[model samples]
Target chain A: AKSVSISVEGMTCSSCVQSIEQHLGKMNGIHNIKVSLEDKNAVVIYDSKLQTPVTLQEAICDMGFDATLAD
Target chain B: LQKHEFFVDMTCEGCSNAVTRVLHRLGGVNFDIDLPNKKVYIDSEHNVDTLLETLKKTGKNASYLGEKSAQ
Candidate 1:
C-alpha cells in the first residue's frame, strides 16, 4: 500500500469531511482515508496497483472540491 | 427569521445534498441550494458567522452574497 496527501479546496463543514470519507471509502483500492477540515487535505492509503494519485485527485474534484497532490 | 444569500463553491448534487443535510440538521435553518448558480439562500435565526461556520463543516468555501428581505 502507498500513501498520498492531497490538498483540497472548497470544503466547508463536518458533513463535507464525512461526505468525502464516505465517497472515497467506497472506492476500490483505498485502504484508509483521513480528511481534515482544519488541514484542508486528505491522506489516503491505497494499493497503488489499483489506483493512482491522479485518480484520487479527480475523484475529489468530481465531488465539487478542487484537489491536487500535496507534494 | 432572516434570509441570507451566499456563494458556495459546490460542484454537484452530492455537494448540495451535503450542504442541505448539514444545515437542516442544525435546526431552525432552511436552505435552497442552486446548483448551477453555485448559490444558496438560507432562512435562519442564526447569525451569518454561525451559518458560515456550519457551512465550513462541509469543506466547501462559502462567501456571503448580501442579505435579501426577510421571509
Candidate 2:
C-alpha cells in the first residue's frame, strides 16, 4: 500500500468531510483514509498498482472539493 | 470569529456523526461538515479553544488549522 497526504480546500463542515470520505471509500484498492479538518488535508492509504495519486485527486475534485497532493 | 481547521482521526459515518453532535452542542452553526475530509467549518460566537476541547473529549485529536478573519 502506498501512503499519500493531500491538502483539500473549501471544506467547511463535518458533513463535507463525510462526503469526501464516502466517495473515496467507494473506490477500489483504497485501504484507509484519515482526514484533518484543522489541517485542511487528508492522508490516504491505497494500492499503487490499483490506483494512482492523480486518480485520487480526480476523485476528490469530483466531489466538489479542491484537492492537491501534499508536498 | 475565526475559521480553524482541525486534523482528526475518524474512520466511519458513526465517527462523523459523533463529531457533529458534539460540535452542535457547542452552539455554532456548522457552515460545512465533510466527513470524508475530516473537516468542519463553523461560524460561532464562541471561543475556538472550547470547541477544540470538546472534540478531544470525544476521543478525537483536533488542532487549530488557522482562522479566516471576519470582514
| TM-score leader | 1
Report lDDT per candidate: 0.82, 0.70
lDDT of 1 by residue, A1-71 (tens): 99999998767677778878987888899999999989999999999999999999987765557789966
Cα displacement (Å) at residue A29, model 1? 0.4
Per-residue accuracy of model 1 over B43-63 as CA lDDT, tens digit each: 888999988877765556888
Worst window of 10 by summed lDDT in candidate 2 chain A: A58-67
Q: How many residue pairs clash in each candidate at the backbone level?
A: 16, 27
Model 2 has an lDDT value of 0.70
lDDT of 2 at A65: 55
**What TM-score, over all chains together, does every model reach?**
0.54, 0.50
Candidates, DockQ: 0.07, 0.03
> Which model scores highest in lDDT?
1
